[model samples]
Target: MDVTVAIDCMGGDHGAVVTVPATRGFLRSHPRAKAVLVGRPEALEQAKGEFGDEFGDRLNFQVAAEVVDMDESPVSAMKNKKDSSMRVAIELVKSGRADAAVSAGNTGALMAISRFVLKMLPDIDRPAIASALPTMKGRSYVLDLGANVDCSAAHLLQFGVMGAMLVAAIEHTDRPTVGLLNIGEEAIKGNEVVKQAGELLRASGLNFVGNVEGDDIYKGASDVVVCDGFVGNVALKTSEGLAQMLASFLREEFGRGLLSKCAALVALPVLKRFKRRVDHRIYNGAVLLGLRGVVVKSHGSADAFAFEQAIYRAAEAASNQLIERIGERMAAMDGVQQA
Candidate 1:
């Protein structure tokens, strides 16, 4: 197998019911990929019986006694739940048994256990969450999504580099453009940290775009967008909420009357096309950047199809050598700074 991923099977609301089927789908779609289903044996027994003969050695299992709760505290999960599915999955990455790890569990616990197990990449003081978000042009990868609430100019610069390298390694784009999330396109628009980060990005040798307003993210103003976690998290949540609200409005309007029902039937194809374009499930996995290993977080409430998308993302990053690429980019930037 070109890529081996460790998946936390006893994670998310549906647990094995969703993750196991998703693993089956992933293995079917990715012939060159292998997956280790990590969870309690009882939860994975049926999966083992079904896929064991089908996949042979391509699919394996590692027993994890405990499961991290969706609301569990990061500290408690880190210190207490040593054998939790989330922790065991990450451990596989650290031991080189898996190229990457994926989990649809507590985001906080996953981040804590991941940092504790895999550690941060060299010269990377902190880890930032990065993910691909759909845009008008195509998609743009944004970083620092709810990882660090407060960030310095240096931290923002690091985020830009990591985000760019992620796009480069996974998307095969060299020198992907980076944009600082700001209030305006002008240089003097945002806070000092953002202003300094823009200057750093401009001089850091990456294809740095000047500044991008919030709406510019959907405009695909740049290939990668960098912002502090506070802003990034707020922006992400707001977008999600807005999408849900618009969808609800559409449903309500369509069901209002008989004439509306007829209109909805006539417009059904166009609505489906729009829904497919904006479906969050298509972009289900979030990359935890700056870690020494590849780790992806799937939405905890994801269904089988959505979870499979996360597996595909993990396999893609592993096969593409995302961690090594990020390290190389960081080292290159350090050399420039020193010279």
Candidate 2:
């Protein structure tokens, strides 16, 4: 399958420095893939030389007249930066020029521009950000990671539906289990919105697994975890920080003495495996679910390898027809609700 990805080259902290190399790396792995690199002409030209002639045909550029600042308000960016790289990249998807769009830009600005350009999917009132996190059994998908801060019960249910479909489509699971994030596993615990959401999930034909706490995320309690953006973002950042802290502690301990260094040498292979398992770079892409088109958000501070992972994720979603699968699931659920 040929997947064409529109890359916002000037959207991230490193901008072309990171995105250009990542695009080249992504194309190397996905031979049938093409990239539309969106940024200033001079930057693209420089990248073209760096990438050499082998990727000349597969790699293309779209000139973006402006760039949205990282600290700019989403509303202001949407209103003023019409020709920004983020907006232009999303426009490629809206215009059917690309299968998916990838950006490591301002999260709010990306969401705003995506909604304005591609709009929401039918039957979806709002979009949620969904991303995969490593777990004991495997990886679990979580949603609303800083997208919609305040969501209704109905919106949480929608997130559940969208997240379930996403896991099903990408992971090839027939009926992925869905769990509502709460303080306790009991049905009665949590705020009114979560309780209502759990009730809705139970009745909504999803594989509702009752409630899961924060630890359940790493325990692989469910394939999909649903929560409001505020809570989800907190959990996401906390886990990231914890992972970094663990790695730092390990490094410090290993460098403490000659005996520790010897132990590290003997355990190098095991540590490498553990590092690969916990590395956030491998799972850098966050899917903006409920949108009409595929838009992946990479970590703003992502390096070349991390951004490449995001590009790969965007291409994978496009190839799997993630948007179509979500639409079908929502339609079926709507039909059942009406019945």
Candidate 3:
């Protein structure tokens, strides 16, 4: 198989109920991809019974004796749940048994276990959570999404490099444009850290666009947007909340009166298209970048389709040699510095 993702079958809200069905759906779509179910064997029994012979060799299982809880502490989990599905899945990636690992478990725990197990890629100081968000033109990748709450100028530069490489691997682009998230379009608008980050990005050999305002994200100002985890996390949560509010407003408007109900019927198709465009479920996967191995974090409450998207994301990263590409870029930077 070109790519094999270890699935944390006992992670997330629905555990095997969602992950198993999602894996089956992902396998059907990606014929070249294989998946290893990692969880308590009994937890995966029903899944094995349902799709055992359907994919046969394309699918396998790695029994994990324990399961990590949704509210578990990273330290507690690591010390107590070594055999947890989440840890075992990451272990598969570290051991080369799997090219990537997909999980919809506790974000902090997943990040901790992954970093502890896989370690950081050479010269990458910290890992970041990167995800694609819908824009007016298309979608743009954003990084440091709640991973490193506090970051230095160098960390932001590293985020830009990793974010660019992620876009390169997934979008097949050689040099994706990168932008700094700031309060204003002007370089002097943000704080000292952002100002220093702007300077570093300018000389980093990547396609560095100047500062972009909050509204510029949806405007598709750049192919990738770079920021520290604090700002990135707030932006992400705000966008989700905004989408929900808008949807609620639309429902309330449509139900206001008979006249509005008639208008809603007339605009039903348009509304459906709009809903599809903004559906958070379609963009459920947030990749943990800068790790030695590929790891994707699915939203904890994701359904089968949303979780399947996460699996597909993991497969794409592995097949496209994402880790190798990022490593090459970092190596090139180091070589330039040495010269």
The prediction achieving the highest TM-score against the true structure is 1
Score every model by TM-score: 0.97, 0.95, 0.96
Mind giving the per-residue lDDT tens digits that candidate 2 earns over 204-240? 9999999999999999999999999999999999988
Total clashing residue pairs per candidate?
A: 0, 0, 0
In model 3, where do residues sit more than 4 Å from their true spots?
A: 185-188, 335-339
TM-score of 2: 0.95
- Model 2 residue runs over 4 Å out of place are 185-188, 335-339
Residues 102-183, model 1: lDDT tens digits: 9999899999999999999998989999989999998999999999999998898899989998888778887899999999
Supply the TM-score for candidate 3. Answer: 0.96
- Top-down TM-score ranking: 1, 3, 2
Q: lDDT, candidate 3, residue 42?
A: 91
Assess the local accuracy of residue 85 in candidate 1 as a C-alpha lDDT between 0 and 100: 92
- Per-residue CA lDDT of candidate 3, range 171-259, in tens? 77779999999996354589999988988888889999889888999999998999999999999999989878988998999999999
The regions of model 1 sitting more than 4 angstroms off are 185-188, 335-339
